[model samples]
Target: MMTYQKMICDGFELNYCIKGQGQPILVVGSSVYYPRLFSENFSQHFQLIFLDHRGFGKPTRAFKQADYTLDKIVEDIEHARQILKLDDLIIAGHSGHAFMAVAYAKAYPQHVQKMILLNTATTNSQERQQQSLSYFEAYASAKRKHQFQQDIALLEQDLKREPERRFVHMCIRMGAHSFYDYTFNATSTWDGVYPNMEIIDYLWGVAFAEQNLLQQIHHLNMPIFVGLGRYDYLVAPVSLWDAMECTPHVKKVIFEKSGHNPMLEEPEYFDEQLIAWINEG
Candidate 1:
């Protein structure tokens, strides 16, 4: 692993940690959280670097609304890339972080060699939220639904108790919906990860909700891999992705037995698919 580096921009102490060798894939989400999600052995197949944006990275101060805007976050990524001199990158982002990867690609296409967007939503809009709910209601097993209800019932009290940990609390409470194994505890993945709910509210609930990344830019040209878990309900469903304008360059693959964090739940298969995609490109 290379030395962990931090870049301060827009009052956010952005972190980027490099590990492994080969094609560089800038993993955008959390320096702590995403690093734990990927197989540590990925160091052999590619140069995987995990990065933190405002929502997941430590903030120097409370951000004014403009400070945490999507445009600024995209530029923050560019700034990190330039400062680190990352060249011909295969930028990757999981879940909502995929928005940053797409936005960065659109803004600085020359810097990107390819893309790997994992378990991302097409749109984070209310309609999509409702669709996810309906899917859960209609298809989820009674056992899963029961666990979800029982687990979510504790969220209110948990949040009230540790207001600062709202994000971690919610994710931990949503284990039934997040992992293939209903009782899988995600506390480890989020152990040292800091979440700024203020920034998350704007980015996940507002900024990303209004944008459709697939339709955001045309002629991206590079091979873009979209990996989804068959059981991931936290983000938009696979059907929504199927409805999008999937150009020839976009390759979407679904993991049959995994949930939101497929790389961890199915590490070997994830590495195989990801490496094959990289090699194919």
Candidate 2:
């Protein structure tokens, strides 16, 4: 692993951690909720670059929802590429960031060599919203209310002192949708309140209002690989399976013992799968 480096893009100082060498693989982090999970877990295989999008992480800017959108995210990514002097990059994303990855491939198909999606939803509109609601309902039903409240209490106690604490609480309720697992869950206590305002708005918009990338998946000119966690609370594994089977350009692997945050849950296992996909590419 290497030291964390900072890069300036669009007037914002983006913080990222890089490691290894060879083909550049830029990781689009999941909005604000869990920013550093993927970069820390998968930095060994490729020249991994994990960045904190605007309003999230440690960016020197205030939270702004209008600036949070797929188009803007794509722009930031291109700026990052320019800074890195990367021509053929492999882009990967999880959760909401996945939409940005797929959309970027759609907008600039020639720039990206490959893509990796983890627990992503390519569908737009009511389908995604209703499905997410169902996922949370199922998760809620399976767990005890007291336990859920306990988690919330932990989160509140931990983040209450942070400046952006309210944003974290909002992000947790919105991103996780109060659908928590009984056994494995990361609270604001463990990770603190770090949801990016832009990430939240963009994800909510695309998941509820915006072609998302469902129709655009077929348009990708690069090899696409999907990593799905077997017990993901946010996105069902079957969703990825169906998407892979439906898209001729997609290859998929399932992490049988993992949940929504596979990279965090099983780092070595997740990296192995990513390496296998890159080698296949």
Candidate 3:
């Protein structure tokens, strides 16, 4: 059985779920999207701890723009770890959350035995942004030619009217194009978790304006696993390549048949790779 619980960390009520047994692996990301996805297969091999960041899941209060910095997020993770009395943790993060995981491991390296970064982008380079935009444009054009133009039109209109819903709508529309294989249903992969737009707006907007972590990550000396999807145009596989060049102790895995979401696109392969990496030590 899974245990759902909450803890007061630095005056904030952080929510987390714990399951399985054996080595502890703390997954810091959007729990609503990845909770069951990680637990279903990982529980048998490791104790999985899924925690929601501020303004996500069951946070005590809504987030303010000033409180959305990467340092603040890392502090929250550390506080949670101390409160839970966890030691020798293996931390993992995906997409935006990967930034937090990296920062946390850097600040508290003694606590983390290993680190996993999945489909993570370290910088908002113009070339990467253009690549993503181009992929979306091509995808839309192809879908429009297939009689799906009406759906595209409606999505654009929805974004224009309710700009705050951009993240939600973008995820829905892009999921279709982001997957390398069409056999997997994207709908089932969605966990129906509403993203904190405030958090998204501030971090991706102001926080990323003058910040890049490609160089800072070189400080990580622990066994680091970097997983990327070959078709992940949103973040681009080059980000992982760039990271691999900087970190001396690093392992890279590229999912040929997946996109930004390898776990959903190829669950069996993802599970096998993750378990093998964990057991490598």
Taken over the whole model, the C-alpha lDDT of each candidate is 0.84, 0.64, 0.72
Tens digits of per-residue lDDT, candidate 2, 102-191, equal: 877887788898998877665546666578657656654444434555556656654666645555554453323323244444455336
Tens-place lDDT digits, model 3, residues 85-111:
998899998877777788899899999
Clash count for candidate 3 is 0
Steric clash pairs (candidate 1): none
Whichever of 1 and 2 has more lDDT, that candidate is 1
Candidate 1, which ten residues in sequence have the lowest lDDT sum?
Answer: 239-248
Displacement of residue 201 (Cα, Å) in model 3 is: 0.9
Q: Which residue pairs in model 3 clash with each other?
A: none
Over 4 Å off, model 2: 30-42, 57-66, 124-127, 136-146, 153-163, 170-181, 185-193, 196-199, 206-208
Give candidate 1's root-mean-square deviation (CA, Å): 1.6
Please identify which of the two predictions, 1 or 2, would achieve the higher TM-score against the true structure: 1
After best superposition, candidate 1 residue 253: deviation in angstroms?
0.7
